[model samples]
Target: MGRQWRDGRGKLVVRGESGDVTLPLEIASSLRARRRGLLGRDFVEGALLLSPANSVHTFGMRIPIDVAYLDRRLRVISVRTMKPGRLGLPRLRARHVLEAEAGAMEGWRVRSGALVEVDTDGGSDAHDRPDSAGTPSLPS
Candidate 1:
């Protein structure tokens, strides 16, 4: 992500050793969007990224999810799988939170220490635009 990201749809690109993983991304930069994240969604087509957040809860969620906490530079500080009705502790170093269907992070190669990029300029022809470095799937 950049210094500033607005609430919208975008793309998340993970730079893995094997290759780059690009997935659909929903950005929740505003307080309203971030607070209502994935609460009623049965499944996430890709992933939801909440900025300026260090923790999350699945109080009203319908499915389990994989959560990854990211630091300022977009480096994943930790990743965990959380079931519905559970609460995740805040990571002191985390500046953002990523949520996806349970187990989707493994398939997408999102792990601790991984780096990600957010592409908010996802148009018909915007691919591999390294605006800056640092930035999932459905449930059963």
Candidate 2:
């Protein structure tokens, strides 16, 4: 599989039963109209990355996915997937959450404590802050 982001561009080439699919990073990373899984079985086209201590709502997804919860140092705290239309409760010790397509973590060899680099084209500084709505937020 190809890396999804490079120089602020989304580099995904999704191959499904129909054909190849390509999407820009802007469209791929935004959490607008997306859902969050509480129990770790819900799936969505995209994920709203959350810190371990934050809450989330999952809705409107085409499939289920695995949620990789990370700690303050980007270490894996727990991993689970929520079914569509679920809610992930807050975990006091979680640092971040990664919502990957089903089996993506295993396929990419991603594990707890893996360092994730955020790439941007406009050269914006990496900002880690909660959104005004009180959700864990990351820069796109």
Candidate 3:
């Protein structure tokens, strides 16, 4: 029901009624990588994905960000634009979190119930963290 991805670069594809939107993706699966996500950087190339995460904070960030909480199925649970110096509420159903520049998600058709696909450099890893979920990972 959850995904186990390694630290790498890839693409995040969001399919919507309009069309497919692809964006550069950075996978943050390690504790260190996920902890340093988008911090201290002026901006991001596209998006950063934090696996096994349910919430995020922007206490020291320089820029605003668009955050999408995804459930175990990669379906968006909710989307929010967070300003600097804010702590996001944890979504009980979220198993992964996607962060992008402020206002970027709106144009990408990222919203509640939207299904997403992560294409890692070596292909998507299918596994589940016992503490995170109990079913298969990303859709094949």
- Show the lowest summed lDDT stretch of 10 residues, model 2: 1-10
Tens digits of per-residue lDDT, candidate 1, 1-140, equal 43447899989999898999999999998999999999999979999999879999999999999999988777889999999999999999988899999999999999999988878776422232223442211112
lDDT, candidate 1, at 121:
76
lDDT (C-alpha) at residue 55 in model 1: 100
Question: 92-140, model 2: which lDDT tens digit per residue?
Answer: 7665566666666555444554434332343323433223453325556
Query: Model 3 off-target regions past 4 Å?
Result: 122-140
| Whole-model lDDT per candidate | 0.85, 0.45, 0.85
TM-score of 3: 0.86
Q: Model 2's lDDT to the true fold? A: 0.45
Question: For residues 103-126, what per-residue lDDT tens digits would candidate 3 score against the true structure?
Answer: 899988999989787877545444
Task: Report the error of model 1 at residue 85, Å.
Answer: 0.4
Ranking by lDDT: 1, 3, 2
